[model samples]
Target: MLLHRLRAPAVLLALALTALPAVAQTPMEDPLDARDARRVDRMEKVVRELRDIVFKAQRTGAPVVVQPADTDARMAELGARISDLEQSLTRINGSLETTGHELELAKRENEALKVQVKDLTDRLAVAEKAVAPPEPPEPPAEEPARAATPQEAFTAARQLMLSGDYAAAEQAFAAYVQDYPEGPRIAEARYWWGKTLTVRNAHAQAATAYIGAIRGWPQTSWAPDAVVELARSLVALKKPTDACQALAELPKRYPKAPTTVTNRAAATRTQAKCAA
Candidate 1:
């Protein structure tokens, strides 16, 4: 309202000035003519009167009157400008608030993504460990235990012989004979033991193993094989006569031997040399 009051007179003055003509052709006149002198005097008196009135008004603190519409219009324009500026401020604040919220949400999402990545990485490591093959444990430097009983040892020795582990089988059978001279499979063990020795080219040892099988268990199932092996071993030992005699007796003693005829003929040939 105070701004309106200040602007009203200025607006009225502007309108009055616009209504007046800015340019005019003046009547020619002498500089010091009586008619011009009278006109100049009249103008000077009018200006003096107006100056006096303005001076008096300044002295007095009287309120200046102005056109109501012009005053009100200028006030309305100012109010509108102020309103526009306030609305612009409100829009800027709202935008700032929205941007802040979006930034906060982005931060939270980033933190959650980091946690998910860490969890996935941890699970991946565990899975790799679970699936990766393990290295085999080193074998003990020493050999394992032997069979306890003589029969057990002999049986083990026979299995080893079948598997062609001749050296191990021979050791097993020797241990058996030393531990239990009268074990049930002694003759069988000795027979195979002798064959194992022959396979290893231990001729003397083979003869000894076969002789032990024949003398200790003459009635055993292994007796025929043992006797034949004994005769062959004796032949290798350069005792052909003893070998032939043993081979000749093999069939009579054990007629069920698998190669009775062949053994008898070979023994007969050797016995002929012995007789000569």
Candidate 2:
């Protein structure tokens, strides 16, 4: 009986083990339900990790990683980026257009200024040519005067002496004496003019002129001419001895003058001849 109880227990343990396998073998509609539940738990864990990463990024001021769930959401994000790019491009294009327009206006103004400067330069050249002054005419050339001859000058001097223009006549006679002291007419002119000056009471000047003619024209034909006149002037000056000496030298200087020899020999015969 004890043995039968023991066998009954063993049989019951085997039957329980056997019934568990049979239940496990039976088919069910939710075959992977537990696996699905585990998969859902793993997905929940990944979501929690992503949330933590996003929180950390926020704290550090960094960008969050996000995934779009649908095409509409992705398309909307792309459209926003495209709109921002278009706005930037529009501003850049507007600035470029404004700069180009300003450059074009400057070019036009510069060209207009160039044309105006050229016109002003041309007008200035024309005005300078039109208002220019004419040159002055040159002056005519002149000829020099001729010099006078000696004979003409001598004739004019004799005429002045005869006219009693004593001062002018003295200058002319002095010039003639300087120019032609040995000429034929010089002794006669000097002797007669000295006598005329003595008669005019110019005794000293008359004596000087007579002495010059006697000393300078000693070899000329007027030697005895000046000698006789000088003797007369010395007598008038109360120089009788000097007058006698001058009278003695006349025949020696002009030996061929018979009149001079006769007059001198007669004058030397008596001291009263000086007074005569």
Q: Please tell me which predicted candidate would have the highest TM-score against the true structure.
A: 1
- Writing each residue's lDDT as its tens digit, candidate 1 over 24-57 gives 1244454567986688676665545444444444
Q: Clashing pairs in model 2?
A: none
- Name the 10 consecutive residues with the lowest summed lDDT in model 2: 1-10
lDDT tens digits by residue: candidate 2, 130-171: 988867754422211221755665676667668876555565
lDDT of 1 at 28: 43
lDDT of 2: 0.66
Question: Taking the candidates one at a time, how many backbone clashes does each contain?
Answer: 0, 0
Name the regions of candidate 2 deviating beyond 4 angstroms: 1-147, 160-171, 178-189, 258-276
Q: What is the Å distance of residue 94 in model 1 from its true position?
A: 99
TM-score of each: 0.43, 0.36
